[model samples]
Target: MLNSTQVSYFTLGAYFDTKQVKYVLFLILLCLYVLIVGSNVLLIMVICVKRSLHEPMYMFLCSLFVNELYGSTGLFPFLLVQILSDVHIISAPLCFLQIFCLYTYAGVEFCNLAVMSYDRYLAICHPLQYHALMSLKKVALFIAAAWITAFLIVTTTTSLSFSLPLCGNFINKVYCDNYSIVKLACSDTTVNNIYGLISTALVVFVSVGLILYTYMRILKVCFSGSKQTRQKAVSTCTPHLASLVNFSFGICFEVLQSRFNMSSTPGAVKVLLSLYYVTCQPLFNPVMYGVKLSTIRSMWKRLFWVKLK
Candidate 1:
C-alpha cells in the first residue's frame, strides 16, 4: 500500500489552455465569489436580525443562504489560487476533501429545497394547521436533517473513495470531484460506483419528488382559490421555483457532461458547465431570493436606503 505522501497529485486539466486569459478569468471569478459571499451574507443578516421575518419559510431561506456561502467557499478559494499559479495541481488528500465539500453542498442543497417546498406546501395548502405542522421545532429539525444527512452521506462516499488505489492522478477538470477521482482507481470500483449511483438516485428522486408533489398541490389549491390567493401563491413561490430551476439546469448540464461523450465540446464550455453549480448557483440563489421575494426586497431596500441616508 502506498503511503499518503507517496500518492501522486492530480493535474487540474481545465486550466491547461487559459494561460493567456488567466488574469481575466481570475478577476471574473473573484468578483463572482465576492458577490456570492456579500449577497448571501446580507440576506442572512437581514433574516437573523429581523424579528418580523421569523417564520418557517424565512428560517429555511436562512439555511439556504448559509449553505450557499458554505458551498462557494469549498471551490472559489482554490480556484482563485490555481488561476494565478503556474502549476494547477492538488494533493490527493485535498482533492478528496474538496470532493466531500462540493458533493455535500449539492446534497444539502437538494435537501434544503425539498424542505422549503414542504414548508410552502403546509403554508399554502394547510394554512389552518400551518403553525402546528411547521413549528419552530419542526423547522429546526428539517434544517438540521438537511445538514447532518448530507454530511454523513458524503462522508461515507468519500471514505469509500479513499480506500481505492489510484493508477493515475490526472483529473481532466477544473476542480476535484468524486467521479473524476474514482475514474483513476486501479482497484475494482464497482462498490464505489454502485454506492454513488444509489446515493445520488435517492437524493435526486426524493428531493425532486417532494418538490413536484408539493408544487402540484400548491398549484391545485391556487387554481381553486380566489384571485388574491393565486397572486399570493405566485408571489411567494416564484423565488423558490426560480432557484430550483436554476439549480436543476446546472445539475443537468453536469450530468450530461459526465454521461455523454464530450470530446468535441469546447474546453471553455466544459469548464463552465462543470463549475456551473458551484459558481453560479451560489450567486443565483441569493439574487433570486433577495429580489423576487417581496419581503426580502423591501427590507433590503430599507436597509440600504437608511444606510445611504
Candidate 2:
C-alpha cells in the first residue's frame, strides 16, 4: 500500500484491453457527443427566443435541456480525450472532481424530473389553478433549488471521499465514480457507504417515487376525463415519461452493476452498461422532448424554415 500523500494518480482499468478499437470508439463517441450538444443547444435557444413558449412547462423543459448540457459537458470532453490516449490515468484531484460533477449531475437530474412531474401534475390535474400554482418566479426558484441542493449533497459525498486513505490507485471502471473511489480506500468505508445510501435514497428514490405518484394521478384524471383530455394528456406526458424511464434505467443498471459482483460479465457488456447513463441520457432527453412536444416541434420548423429562406 502506498502512502496516501504519494498516491497522486489513479489508473482507469476499464479501457485497458480496447486499444485496438480506440479510434473507432473515439469517432463514434465524438459524433454522439456533438449531436447531444447541438440538439440540446438548439432546443434551449428556441425556448429562450420564442415568446409563445413562456410557460411553466417549457421553463422546466428548458432547465432539463440545460442540465443535460451541463452533465454531458462534465463527461464527454474528458472521455473523448481518454479514448485517443494510450494510458488511462487521472490525477487524484481531477478524479474526485469528475466524481463530484457526474454525481451532482445525477442528483440534479432527479430533482429536475421531480419538479417537471409536479409541473405536469399541476397543469393536467388542476388546470384551473395551473397558472397560479406555477408562476414564473416559482419556477425559477425550483430550478435554482434543484441545482443548489444537488451541489450541497454531492459536496458531502465528495469531501468524504477526499478524506479517505487510499490503499490502491486502480479504478476498475472507465470513469471516476463514488463507489469505485471508496472501494480503493485502505480504511473501512462504513461512513461513506452509509452516507451514500442515505443520499441515494433521499435524492434518487424519493424523486422517483414522486414522479410515479404524479403520473398515477395524471393517468386517473385522463381516464375520468373526456377523449380530448385524454389525448392532450398523452401528448404532453409521453415525452416526459419516456425521458424519466430512459434515465432511470440507465442509472439503475449502473448502480446494480456497481453493487454486485459481475466478474463473469463480458468486458464489452460492462463497457456498454457503464456508458449508458452518461452518454445516452444526454442524447435522449433533447431528442425526446424536441420531437414529442407539439409546440416545440412547430416552433422548430418555423425557425428552420425562416433561417433557410
lDDT of 2 by residue, 1-309 (tens): 764567899899888557678888889988999999999999889899999999998898898888888889888889889888888999988888899889988999999999999998998899999898899999999999999989999999999988888889998888888898888888989999899899989998899899999999999999899898888888888998898899889997898788899999987788789779878999998888888889988998897899999
Per-residue lDDT of 105-171 in model 1, one digit per residue for the tens? 9999999999999999998899999999999999999999999999999999999988888777778
TM-score for each model: 0.96, 0.97
The number of clashing residue pairs in each candidate reads: 0, 0
Predicted structure 2: lDDT: 0.89
Q: List the residue pairs that clash in candidate 2.
A: none
Worst 10 residues of 1 by lDDT: 1-10
